[model samples]
Target: MIFIHPTAEVSDKAKIGDGTKIWHHAQIRENAEIGENCNIGKGVYIDFGVKIGNNCKIQNYVSVYHGVVIEDDVFIGPSVTFTNDLYPRAFIWSEEKVSKTLIKKGASIGANSTLICGITIGKFALIGAGSVVTKDVPDYALVYGNPAKITCFVCECGRKLENFEDNKKDNLVKGICKFCKKEIFINKNNFKKWKK
Candidate 1:
């Protein structure tokens, strides 16, 4: 059972899966495919041809532009903006100018963040509030700040992994969650570009 509010504008060409709920004044554009049990908050804008996977939660007034793909169980907080173009000119608009952004499964982006195009946000990565993500984020990374540097690695439960930063000397590091005691192995080479 999909519920689209009376004020929402969902195009007939869009494919929305079962149990999805679109809130008031949200706009789902043509060819956008949203998977099952997703919650699209009020005033959200999902651009044409964007694909969102199952059980995702998109908060109010978030703008998911064209060329962005969101995988399952992703959480996008309020007013998060996704950019599709590297260069912006008011008069210059073309599909060729659009760069793709991929948000891997189980990633959580904090409120008011801006994700630049052509970057892949890795699985279970946590992006802090008001961050400006300019490049690819490694899996299980906890990234924040302008240009979004990796501060540490986090567990799947969103808890900071113990001793991740202290053990960065090796090419491969093991991160253990203090709360959940789950071990996650991460390759430090993946973070070479953003290393401190």
Candidate 2:
């Protein structure tokens, strides 16, 4: 069952999957696709053509504009802003000027983060609070700060992979997570979680 608040403006043309809940004053524009079990928070605006995958938790006041795609299991913290236009002009309106931004599966963005357009946030990556992301984040990376630099590698469980540097040999690094006891293999920019 889908529940939309009385004050929310959800277009009939929008595709809302089952079990989705749209909170107060949320506006889901035409052609926007929201997958199942999503929580569209208060005052959140999902622009036309935006695609959101299943189980996404979009916190209060988040702005998901056109040209943005969020994959499944993503958590967008409160007040997060996704900008589609690289340059602003009050009189200008052009779909060609909007840049694409992708938030891959299982990623989490902390509160008040700003994602500049035209960047891909990789799968299972963690963005700390108040980050200003401007580049493509690698998978399982923990990135934060004004420019969102990758500070360390993290597990899918959101625990830091301690001493990852010590396991590097050739192009692959293998380590056992202390918290979850799961084995992980990192091959350059790609990482995989395996059972022990």
Candidate 3:
């Protein structure tokens, strides 16, 4: 049930899973692995060595650069940009230890967020639109702004859930991850997060 458009250029080395749909003008580069039921929108550029998991949604004009490993059911919003170089240099291979950015399962990134390399965004974490992520984000944490900070805890239901931040007892919430406390919200329609 794959729906790849004719205008799109998919490399032979790329592995596209069943039920995946590559839209108009989208390009999946060599060695890119897209999982089942994923919807790659128009003008999306999936770079080499990038791996996307099942049921993911990548919107228009987004760049999934090399060394990015996106887990299952993640939602990448429109115009989202992922940077692979920490301190980019034209003359040298000075990535400055630019490690890979790992997005765990069920995370939802808002439109136009910029993810800096070497940062591991926690599972089920919600990154707000237009954020510049610099460091590691915890799971189930709702973050925003230039150097993305935790503002609230988001439920898997797309509601702003209660935060046990002030609680003296350290206990795990049901359906949420241990680090971020993000609930396991699988996308209903096609793996994209719905704005509540």
Q: What is the C-alpha lDDT of each candidate?
A: 0.94, 0.90, 0.82
Write the residue-wise lDDT of candidate 1 on 123-187 in tens digits.
Answer: 99999999999989999999999989999788999998876543556677777899999988787
Using lDDT, rank the candidates from best to worst.
Answer: 1, 2, 3
Model 3 shows how many backbone clashes? Answer: 3
Off by over 4 Å in 3: 94-98, 163-196
Query: Candidate 1, which ten residues in sequence have the lowest lDDT sum?
Result: 162-171
lDDT tens readout by residue for model 2, 3-104: 999999999999999999999999999999999999999999999999999999999999999999999999999999999999979999899999999999
TM-score of 3: 0.82
Q: How accurate is candidate 3 locally (lDDT)?
A: 0.82
lDDT of 3 at 160: 69
lDDT of 3 by residue, 1-196 (tens): 8889999999999999999999999999999999999999999999997999999999999999888999999999999999898778777774354569999998999999999988887777899999999988777678899988777656654566642332224333333445546644322221112223
Candidate 3 clash pair list: 139-180, 140-180, 140-182
Index of the highest-lDDT prediction: 1
Question: In model 2, how large is the Cα lDDT of residue 57?
Answer: 99
For each of the candidates, give the backbone clash count: 0, 0, 3
Model 2 stretches astray by more than 4 angstroms: 163-170, 189-196
Local distance difference test, candidate 2: 0.90
> How accurate locally is residue 149 in candidate 3, as Cα lDDT from 0 to 100?
77
